[model samples]
Target chain A: MENFLQFNSVSYFYQTKDNEIQAVKDLTFSVNENQFASIVGPSGCGKTTILSLTAGLLTPSTGEILIGNEKVGKHDGKVGYMFQRDHLFEWRTIWQNITLGLEIQKKNKDPKKLARAEELLKKYDLYNFRNKKPRQLSGGMRQRVALIRTLMLEPQLLLLDEPFSALDFQTRLLVCDDVYDIIKREQKTALLVSHDISEALSMSDRIIVLSSRPACTKQVVDLSFEGKTPLLKREDKEFGRYFETIWRSLTNENQKTS
Target chain B: MAGILKPFGEVLPMKTKKQVNFSQAHKKYIKRLKQEKILVVFLQIFILALLLGLWELLAHFEVIDPFFFSSPSRVIKCIASLIAGGEIWMHMGISLAETVIGFIVATLLGAIIAILLWWSERARKVSQPYLVILNSLPKIALGPMIIFWVGSGFSATVVMCVLICIVITIISLLNAFTSCDQDKILLMQSMHASKFQILRKLILPNAIPEFVSVLKINVGMSWVGTVMGEYISSSAGLGYLINYGKSMLNLDLVMASIILLSILAGGMYFLVNLFEKRKQQ
Candidate 1:
């Protein structure tokens, strides 16, 4: 697999009236194609800041980020971001909401792209509820709709920002399996930021853990589960041990902060 | 389970099932009865009764002179007399026409100008201060100047409404465009979305809520603009009716005109509300 997205020694600062607050300090990482990677860190550890940088929403104060060997000077739309909130427009029906990006991009005129979007909705079991509004759907279903909407854009990279955090525990487990299955089947690369240890452990092929604020990579853990999917992986005997290791890494950082 | 909507933990198990059945049936009954709707109607009736009763008592005691205050009765009688005399329609027509013209014209111009300002960053920076000063300047104070420029009647009324509404529409829509969620915008930008794409895709649709809010605000403002214009320049319309009544010391007609204006204003307000409800749907 090719190294499709690379973050090279990136640093950022938030300049306010009084002082400058460092966000990502000399962070470096690269994700390969078809990889399911999760970035876990303490609150305000600049995990989101890193994604923003990779997505080219911010100019690095130092170092460069390369996507397919091109420096990210400005925003590139090949990144699909799923925030904690679904951000689905309530006024629009499910199908309309999903095709919103294409409509705005005027790609809806392309029959091939339109078919792909339609097929994705059908594939995801949302075709039946195509004309329904998001407010009419359950929390788990809405997140699926949101994911399909992002996938409709045919983005090269999918960024998940604690997407399952808003769901109940039971729903979270189900949606995590649903999402992980979708990402793998689609064969798309993903970078997920999450606080849930089990979720990250189950879903990710590689986990990049970060220290507290002015965040830098603390450790990178690689997992190989004999199970086929995240749900099955969660039932593996080593699940608790993986959770403990990640929890200990996180708790040790918390102690240092105090 | 959507636990926010119920608290069933406190009930005993066997009886809880019975209570759940009872509550479920009771809930259906309440929903079928349209309790919220009934409460609204009940509240409206109570308020009407209280107002009418207070007015009757006040009139009975002569605490407010009938000749001066022209109690609710006098206003109703004035409406009845105006109808019998076949002048109510004439007054209603003039006022309605002025309001409709002013509202449509102002809303169209306001929306157009807002879009224009949103399209250009330099134009926004350039026109912003002038717009702020223009918006801040009381439109009512422009009444005499407008009457001078447009020379009374329809054009003056329309101009007043435009002044009252356009600035607000521009400011509201411009703010809406800028206030779009940054994360969503980033998603678009990474796609190499064009400026037009960003505007059409991201900003415009999100701006609908703010646009609706401003439309509601514009309804009342346009009424003010039209009536104030009528007061300053017109020989017809509800404003003219009140001015004529005041000039002749016919307090009954003045009260009648105000009641008529309220009805028209309320109707416009209701129309905007209907649009909002439709948008939600």
Candidate 2:
């Protein structure tokens, strides 16, 4: 099957007054349609640069990125990005935040789009808090709201950048399950960037391990677990084995770079 | 008598002891809250009374010369006579009108100019040095030039108020606009939001707290600019009254005018506070 998203030899660099810092080099990967993929790497290993490139927030220094077989542009609406911070407009209520993209695109008045938003909010259990500001909700609920907001745009691909790293351990586990459930239930293609090996392993069907700064694709690991949710996946016997492999790949990459 | 009391208590035994205890605690909590509020009011009044009494006593004992210092009682008397004569109303109206006009116009114009600067990076770079220079210059130094340009009157006062307020508004708002979370802007960009849409949806909403702060500062600046304008040239205003009283050495009138000016400025500041409170809610 053709890839739903593709990075064709993508590379990125940050230019400064006196120096240029290569963030990613010759990185290439793809996520099949409706597949949950994750990119895991060492801290500051330019994992986020990959997401930014995919979202077309930054152009690749060389090579190209494609979504749904079409090239991505600087302001393409085909991609939805969830940042580390919830990034919900504090001044706007949950409902307003959800519809922000639609409002910008001038599709907010469409009945079908509004109904889809309402349906998503209801499905995610955020319908009741629709009128409340983002701050009033707990961290997990806020992330859910953020996810729902991005989902409202109905992007072809969702890029989650450490979406639950800000939550406490327990909340992170629950949010990971919730976010994974939403993405799967919606049958949407997703590409996640995480430093947590277990998080990447449990949530992703396929994982791309990246090397340290000037990151390149170190290895690609495909995961399958009998358990359904991320929480239950931790109990799967294969979970430990998959964790070890990804951990070793990451550490080995770190050792070589250091 | 003990048997009768026991039977009476037994008649009300349907109410649980826990319920009675909870009700008692709730009542005490409410009463304490009320008492705290009353204490705050009482302390405020007490402070004012003590300060005024000290001023009156000092003047009475000639520790501070009453002629120059003007005791609180004399200031009150002066105010009472002015009210009775009804001439102070015209001056108060003139100053209030000028200040209000200046405040509103300056705030709106400042916000628009800030938006313009934020919209264009080249424009912002070009205007940066000029804005810094203007903010640092004493606005009052432009008084003579303003009068020459606009002719001394309410318009000139408003121009002065704008001069005092607009630069600070631009600087603070530009800072706020620039400092809005870059990630949020990127999120909007990924949604294909236009620059103007991003400004409307993200930057402006993000700048609200800063905007409220700017308004609060402008309230004082507006008053300063208006009073300074009146000082330079005004036929009637509290500032004019103060200047006129000083010429005649009628310190009581000068003290009364100062008191009125403070009250008016305080009232304007309170209104801005009310706006902020509403926004927060």
Candidate 3:
């Protein structure tokens, strides 16, 4: 498969009043078409910053980011971002929240997009809650709605920025499976940023480990597990081996940084 | 005793197995709530009656001078005569108009200024200290300046009300707008939404409850402004009546005006509360 998203020696700097801090340093990686890529790193390792760059919320100070062979730009509609929090407007109903992008893009009048929104809600078992406000839903359900809201825009690539972090462990596991299933079913390329090694191992086709800030790619491990679902993948015999490899890489990075 | 009991099951019968009557319990719970509400209202009325009775009894016995303290019956009689003579209505109407106008203008002006401040970081930063100073400064101090600037008339009274309320509105609304969740704003930005779109779709909607609260506060503030303005310079209004009655040493008219002012303030507050309820729904 061709590279759908690429970052070429990307570097980013954050400017404060007194000093400039390097966030991401000389990072290079690529994820192929329809592939699920996960970036695992230590806490505060600028994993979210990298995702922000991909989403075009921030621009890299050096090198280039390419999405489908085209350079990334500010507010590019080619990418969809799912934040750590669901970030659903509490005052708006589920349907209204899902259609928020369309309204912003002035495409709400488009029947095709509206129908797709309805279909996604029904497929995800959220149709019954379409009229309900976001607060009325469970944590997992709200995340699903957040994902569906992003999907309504039909972006070429999806960026998941630790979307499951806020959830409890049980809900996290269930939501990981649900999110993984939906991404694969949609056949869209995705890059997820997470600190949870097990979570990355279960859901990713390719796992890229990163060193501490300013973050640089440490290792990229390609996996061929026996099971399709994340739960089943967790049960795979090799799951433990991959977990150990990533954890050691992470711990080594932490040691070097400290 | 055991033979007489005939075993627990035989004595009570299996059909008589204990079961909670949920409907009856629910009824009793609802009745308790109703009784509490009634008791609250009754106590409130009793407190008012007690206060009024004490005042009336004291005034009747000349323990306090009725001429100075103004007895409840005198105030009531004064209100009745004012109504019969059809004079109080004009004053009430003028005050009400000034308050309503001031309340609306102040709220809108404050909201607009807040939006402007929110739109530019430089503007917000620059104005922060000034806004703080303006908010803390006594609005009544502006009464004389407004009377001269706007000419001691209806305009002056309305201007006074606006000045009092607008500062608070701007401060509160700007706080609301600035404190909007950064993540939600980023969400909108990621979708390529314009600033206005974000404000309209997220920030404005998010600040609605704050806006309602601002309205609630403005209702009271505007009344204060109007009355203060009228006291400074006015030919008509309840404030004028109070001031005029004071000059004439007619305590009954002053007390009556005070009562009327309370009723009008209460009515405005109730309207704002209704608006809040409707928005919540």
Cα RMSD to the true fold for all candidates: 5.5, 8.0, 8.0
- Residue pairs clashing in model 2 are none
- Candidate 3 Cα errors over 4 Å, as ranges: B1-27
Candidate 2 lDDT tens digits, B104-132: 99899989999999999999999999999
For model 1, fnat equals: 0.31
TM-score of each: 0.83, 0.93, 0.93
TM-score of chain A of each: 0.96, 0.97, 0.98
Query: Could you tell me which 10 consecutive residues in candidate 3 chain A have the lowest summed lDDT?
Result: A132-141
Off by over 4 Å in 1: A13-21, A68-77, A248-258, B1-28, B31-65, B71-90, B116-138, B171-176
Docking class for model 1 is acceptable
In candidate 2, stretches whose alpha carbon ends up further than 4 angstroms from where it belongs are B1-31
Candidate 2 on A211-239: residue-level lDDT in tens? 88888888998889999999899999999
Q: Model 2 chain B: which ten-residue window has the lowest total lDDT?
A: B7-16
Writing each residue's lDDT as its tens digit, candidate 3 over B1-281 gives: 23212211122122224656668878999899999999999999999999999999999999999999999999999999999999889999999999999999999999999999999999999999998898899988988888778899799999999999999999999999999988889889989999999999999999999999999999999999999999999999999999999999999999999999999999999999999999987
Pick by lDDT: 2 or 3, better one: 3
lDDT of 1 at B68: 79
Q: Is candidate 1 or candidate 3 better by DockQ?
A: 1
Candidate number that wins on lDDT, 1 or 3: 3
